[model samples]
Target: MGSGSFSISGSGSGSGSSLVLDGERGELVRAPAVRIGKKGGGKGGLLDEKAMIALRNHSEAERRRRERINSHLSVLRGMISGTDKLDKAALLAEVINHVKLLKTTATEHAKGYTIPSDTDEVTILCEPQPANTTNTSFLIRASICCDDSPELYPELKQSLQNLHARVVRAEISSLSGRVKIVFFIIPERGEGNGEMGRKILVDSVQHALRLALERVNSSMEFIPRDSLLNKRRRVSHFESSSSSS
Candidate 1:
């Protein structure tokens, strides 16, 4: 049969429902008031193949979309989970590792006698605000500290000549002792209002400083050694001298 029909009727004692099977129209009709016997005639309902396929396709699409969203959410969850417990010590350690890597790479490049490129023409400095104030903005400073080499100094000077146009007001201050280098730092007024912007500024400044320090250290050729043993030896010597005195 192409289509079958069925009837749902009330059963005995004004209670219970019965479904009568009709094999002709393939439709199930409901008869709530009439009572039904155990007689086995009528039609069964038609099943629409097109509707079933469309419903299955919709459900599959929804499932795939849900899975994709869940994958992104899982990545975000992992990032936030670690960030939630981030402390000063953890941040310091991360910075130290990064600095060490930069130092190593810079030293390797210097060993090969690689000259500074256009990207290294200007130096960026990020300094935190004084402890007395309640503001959250960092002082982002940019300058050229290449007075030693005339060729490099000219390029650096030209790059940083328009510092006022790029950032907040800049001032040239002589760093105390040794060299005649001037520091061009940002003023407090240009710092933004939010913590996120402040953090970005601080991190940018730190990365720039790390790059400069790496270059300087590469030039100077600094090597790390165990200081604890020297400290212990000094303590022993001081104690022996004190005892003799």
Candidate 2:
């Protein structure tokens, strides 16, 4: 019949064309006729077995990497919270301390108390008066035990200027071994009145003081070599001047 080769077995129904089976070899003896409607049935067309396995492995690796990054962020959060640095707790404490220091100093002033004269140490001195003045203000006297150098004066001035407070006046006193800075903070009128104005003034001054200290401490932590050299030069100049005198 057909030109294509076919097999005829012993029990062939008709000798036209017949297919044989090979059970032992697990292979088809004759090619099966292609169905006209069948189009895209294939093993290597879409994604093969190896490709699927690779896709699954890549997805799992990405998931694990994201999990690790999240874990690190959590640890940093815990550390910041525990240390109270740059967090809500530190801010609240700063506000509370400001209020307390102001109240104590005011009370002492109202009672005609004399502030202890220990300029070499850190202290808060207050002088209160009746509400007859034009403006409510805080006269802050800050003293610190640091080197006495002309170069430091400008740095100290710059730091105070950065406070953004309404400064009435600033006085710097360079003693034998330390420097003293005094700031008179006058709260602008219409900000508040009566007790509220006093509170606002006190809070503002305290906040400024805190900022100044933070800056000073930061500067002290990493003093530039050039600044240190200038300081030494000043010290030598001072010594020479004293010896000549």
Candidate 3:
């Protein structure tokens, strides 16, 4: 013999009534209906306050998440061209492709071998923003030729970062105990007076980078100490042992 489950089916809210059960016969019983939020259900005003609040909170969180995503996407679009026309999904795909391309480029650049100039010289060129950039930024190239100190690159980069200049690319070549660094940089615009104060920026950056290079060179202890001597020591031609008087 099979036993039947005692499940109650009910409709309509604001009630706690159930059908009378006789064990031997079949009767339909209904459970009490609960409503916490206010809403129209057919002709009756039904409500589910708890569920409503939960749904509202979830919606608010989702809205905020979308806003954050859109804000980041806008920034990315500005950083890369041709992305403004894309939809959300397409924009994300383009960003992925862009990142992959940059990764491959950096890998290719690493294969190049170089030896920077041995002369202790610092050359910095600051290029004004082009027509495409709308005079909003500057492209600066700083090349420093100095003796190879292992800590030079990190210290140099940190110094520039401290000066509000963000490096875009660096070309480093070392050979024969000498090193050369060519840094392509973009200095922050807002750190200046809205538009670039060209001379002020150039002078300040030059001074800062020059100081950094000076510190690195001065701290290095690899230079030879013996330069001038009174006389050259002559090699003795005598085969036999000699006694000094």
Which residue runs does candidate 2 get wrong by more than 4 Å? 1-126, 129-133, 137-165, 224-245
Q: What is the C-alpha lDDT profile of model 1 across 1-245, one tens digit per residue?
A: 11112345554663445353423334553322333233452222112334334544554666667678657555544644353355546644655676698899988876632232333344555667676643333566554332122233343344434332223343331221111222334433454447665556545554554455445435533333232113211101111101111
Q: Model 3: per-residue lDDT, tens digit, 26-128? A: 4543323333234544322234334334544554666667678889999999988998899989999998999999999977885654445647888888776
Instruction: Flag regions of model 1 displaced more than 4 Å.
Output: 1-177, 180-193, 220-245
- Weakest lDDT window of 10 consecutive positions for candidate 3: 236-245
Write down the TM-score of every candidate.
Answer: 0.22, 0.33, 0.40
Best by TM-score: 3
Q: What is the lDDT of residue 224 in candidate 1?
A: 32
True-vs-predicted CA distance for residue 121, candidate 1, Å: 19
Model 2 TM-score relative to the real fold: 0.33
* Candidate 3 local lDDT, residue 80: 85
- lDDT for model 3, please: 0.60
